[model samples]
Target: MDGYQVYRDAMTKDQWQGWWVTWPLSTRVRLGHVYDRKSDGVRRAGDLAARGIPFQREHGTPDGTFIYDSNESVDVAFKASGKTPAALSALTEADAGASVTFTRGRTAFVVFREYSQSGISDVRGLSHALVSAWWNKEWDDSLLAVTSVVAAAGATVLTAAEGGAVAELKVSASAGVGELGMADLALGASVVRHSALGAQWTGTDVTPFYQVIRLRKNWLGKIVAEYGPRPPGRGALPSALPPLLSEEIGDDPEAALEPGDRTEELPFHDPENE
Candidate 1:
């Protein structure tokens, strides 16, 4: 049997914008990156936390020889839904600790929100320098999607039509070595295939993903209960400041709500109704 296209076979045009990335799993570092194992653990955890990458913390041995601790992998998947407006709105409204649900073809797919470590990092380090220098020149001024060789494609690749492609991350330098002088440094990670919750998903560990999400269930039709403090509601939206010229002494602070403000119930009903 041939492979079936998930989106193209199942969804419509307006559903194109419903893509989401999963939380980043704190990467396993070699001895070079670990100054102090415990301290490094804290820092790495903080890094994932700060970026809101949802990750599973593990503390066990896969083979009973080596005990693995820290974020081993990220649960990355695409969210499909017919509730396009509701899903899109939830992306802006949901917090890292919350999960948003969307419907597609009478089935509901929910994605839990979290932070993602997807862009350049300011910290000065070997890995950061490698990623920054690579992205600065290679990915600048271009749309990029990087996946493993099995799912690589050119500029025309579409998730809906293809339903099976990796986001690309192309990097090349004239001199293989940069200031760090590691002449042949390369990065490698795993990408996995998942078929569940009425969707077929393929994901790599970390490939410059922006949004962090968690699926509400595993392949066995079980709800994966996530643990964390419920994040506070996206608070009162901020009012825009006056323009440069209007910043003069007498300029009134404009009280108009921007287009993205969440409409809330008025605290007080009309006096006439009362």
Candidate 2:
């Protein structure tokens, strides 16, 4: 095939890149925004999101996330689902990182891109102790590490996971139970320069519903640590156990009595006296 020949020729060139260039390193890698069935303007990025939005004729994954309208240049909308005054205040205070999902035919989907906050990201090289002690046995290790927190800056508060100023964590777990994992990663670390919501971005007709979640490294570490097992041989005291109710007592009153007890028999003349 001519295309194959062209590929062979391109490979001959030192600068030529191939399929691996576009290959995804991880399944959880951020892709892009997803348009739901109900969403008016945005298109769905089929099968790519794993949610499987069917592709319309001539419309595919890239087309769904990005539409190059000559008239509008491109259509994009930022919707803030928060109705509270504080929500507005937080938006005003700092650019928020958000995960936006629109529904399509009762199924929700988003674009898979490096910047998509909604997408999952794997935390690789997890500590053995962290895995055995903290991680749930049922959960897949590859799916464990994701974008735990994201903070964005902009007028409408476009939340982004990648391609913005980010604090990258370099975490490691210590051996033994109950030992705290160390986070030597820098706080407020800077991310590579990339497109952000602002001059280059505009709005669309579709109203996007999203939530504002705040997470920090310390908070994430706390969560990871909390899930960890307690140190070995550490037993709870009897006092720590919940107290039993009187109804739970045995039928035999003598058996039910504790170390100290006094029993008295009243006269049987209750009705006779009356």
Candidate 3:
């Protein structure tokens, strides 16, 4: 039997009510906002409030001690089921080969991008440019609020994984004219400058992580040259283990696993790789 299954079977109905068990990184990222450090589990409320995502919470115990109670957990598990070939098919599909279109002058440009890892970096830049254009009456104002929310949520998730608070993050933007050209845009295009968001961590290692939003614009004041989103491969949190599961799994739970156990595939389950 799987180690997680073994652990679950060992618990009583009441004991299970006081704990939230989860084992996937993608699911955890989707439901990051609901976790409470003091309660040590997911909140029982189904209301996402200001989070604004389509998913909701489910199966929560009265005491709010279960992580699987969240709707995102159920969704991830459904995707992981035999019904799908990939473990996180929906999430991976969304992240794989996604693109957005923005216009520069009379020409339309399609930019392929993803949202996992450093793909959030691309969002940061697009959000900056869209908001700037909206403020300057160059673009539709309808997308301003939506763009802000998505960018903020992405930043929160990325920083939360590193134990950083999003509220303390500092952001700055600047605009200037420059000559820029890329395969996606015409040669010698006049482009607007980039904006950057600086995120600082709250532990012994206080190095700040900077997310630069590049929104290149042509002479016609239209966006161009938005590409290249890569992950910040370094800077893993000092404690590789996620705080939510540390107590349930212990310092070294894998040693007790029997053969054929696949818990190693779960992120944060394998401390070395996390």
> What is the C-alpha lDDT profile of model 1 across 118-166, one tens digit per residue?
2222212222222222222321111111111011110111121122222
Each candidate structure's TM-score, on Cα atoms with residue i matched to residue i, is 0.16, 0.15, 0.14
Off-target runs (Cα >4 Å) in candidate 1 are 1-108, 121-197, 200-274
List ranges where model 2 is wrong by over 4 Å. 1-125, 134-149, 155-274
Give Cα-based local distance difference scores for all models.
0.20, 0.21, 0.21
lDDT of 3 by residue, 140-185 (tens): 3211111111111111111111111111111111101232111111
Candidate whose lDDT is highest: 3
What tens-digit string does per-residue lDDT give for candidate 2 at 63-124? 11221111222222221223222332222212222222211111111111112123222212
Task: Count residue pairs with overlapping backbones in model 3.
Answer: 4
Backbone N/Cα/C clashes per model: 9, 25, 4
Give the number of colliding residue pairs in candidate 2. Answer: 25
Stronger candidate by lDDT (1 vs 2): 2
Tell me each candidate's RMSD, in Å, in order.
Answer: 25.3, 29.0, 29.0
Q: Give the number of the best model, judged by TM-score.
A: 1
Instruction: Provide the lDDT at 145 for model 2.
Output: 22
